[model samples]
Target: MDLGIIGQAAGLFAVTNIDDILILALFFARGAGHPGSTRRIVLGQYLGFTAILAVAVAAAFGATFLPESAVPYLGLLPLALGLKAARQAWKSHRNGAGDQEDTRAEPGGGPGALEVAAVTFANGGDNIGVYVPVFATAGIGGMTAYAVVFLVLVAVWCFAGRFFATRPVVARALARWGHVLLPLVLIGIGLLILVEGGAFGL
Candidate 1:
């Protein structure tokens, strides 16, 4: 209930998650006409975020017991995902109709919650790193307070993303470049995480 906790949590969530808005906006634009798309995206975001928080919680509690050397290797998760995405993007670019084909086929009737969750988790490697340190410093009460604020802010983020997706200029730009940029962004994040964590000493 401390105002300081709320402020810190809100600020961290907002600042650290700015990129999420663009990604979520792309999702919203892609699923524009699909029924239940909004619900699925929001649910998937929550699930993915919950997974990140779980990892953060575990690391914070067992920081001393866990091997710091292995932490940086976790970047591989996003790196592998980025490679897969790059392959897909390349294929889509090679085949004139490939992107359209992908658009028509939803993993489960329209970007099911699981698929979105996978992407969210893959994109959240940095979130886990940043959150672990914060959680490690906070007590149980403070952690709980931060969690509440974070969850609430997540909804706000989703709304903002959806709003952005509805804008004509934003929608067009995302539709055109999202596929290509997302993969590169993921790759960059992975490398950044590895370097920051001193993985491979680089």
Candidate 2:
């Protein structure tokens, strides 16, 4: 309800504010790499990011149509998500989870919107966690902003992915570190929220 106050304080701008989508865009691009070498995978990265953000925007809008209870609970998201990412990354490190290259995204080599979408949808393994609750507070303005930022970030990541595939070892190293780094960073941020909420006796 207090969108203005919240937005200003949070520096929220709609679609752009969704850090998860942006991260997905970046990682997908980093791993996706080499459009010339692998067009389908690169394109798939793009469409996948777009679809997830679109769903997130819709969910954020839906929050408005539904209930005010949605607003307060938004605080838990970044922390919970961040922690989850950390756990997943830790697991992936142990089990080689992030190591799997998508067969569809690879796709014998071609690029099109539909192909992109399919690859994207395929990469959409954890769709719900990415789209839901966060968007629950997104209004129309937020959604549009989210979309624009998300798209721009995706474009940048895709470009990077396509451009830089020569150093496979380095890229993979960064990718592995990213899995651990991003989540911990996000989790720390979430913990900050708890601090501000006075949940702990200061």
Candidate 3:
């Protein structure tokens, strides 16, 4: 089942997801004020995400359980996060913050590898759910494939997140109202999580 690896990877993926979220936020900040690069963001996405996931997978190796009970609650997090994102994007548009909104938005050109790492570390909230307890339990044999699933998932998401952030259509949509949708989806999942929390938490 590769459960062990999967558990570990899950935690790492969660953290990476959080980094991407922050990257998106910065994308807007730069677009309106500074102007970050696609390469730097992508590189950064990989950095913070890779490190966290690595540790998580390793942890899953000889442990028992990673608190699968939190899965439901974790599931809801995405929806809430997405919705909130959309709302903010919409508000930015309404306010006509304009590309030249704030000097603070000034992007630090060339998001070099180190910069990427810094950004990844800076955005950890997004991974709070699946990241922490993903493999907190016990029982596991060979977990190579399990970890791969999560590693791949997070890696892909980070790539896409950065790519999308730099896209004109995506940026415009986000500026218009994408954050709202993201958060609402999270809300729905949150409700489901609540149910899980009440019923079979495991």
**In lDDT terms, which candidate is top?**
1
Off by over 4 Å in 2: 1-42, 63-116, 125-127, 168-202
1 or 2, greater by lDDT: 1
Writing each residue's lDDT as its tens digit, candidate 3 over 26-104 gives 4432334335565555565567556655545554454423354543444444444445555655666677755325433
Put down candidate 2 lDDT per residue, 46-102, tens digits, no spaces: 676666566555555553332333322333555666676667656656765445443
Please name the candidate that would achieve the greatest TM-score relative to the true structure: 1
Pairs with backbone N, CA or C atoms under 3 Å apart (clashes), candidate 1: none
Candidate 1 residue-wise lDDT, 1-202, digit = tens: 9998999999999887898897788677666757788899999988988877777788888754335576666666667767877887687778776666656555444445775676677567677778887888897888888889988988999999899988889878867887776667667767876888899989
Clashes of 3: 39
Deviation from native of the Cα of residue 44 in model 2, angstroms: 3.1
Residue 166 Cα positional deviation in candidate 3, in Å, after optimal superposition: 4.3
Ranking by lDDT: 1, 3, 2
| TM-scores, all models, native as reference | 0.78, 0.38, 0.42
Off by over 4 Å in 1: 30-37, 63-66, 98-112, 129-133
Clashes of each: 0, 10, 39
Error of 3 at 157 (Å): 3.3
Number of the candidate with higher TM-score, 1 or 2: 1
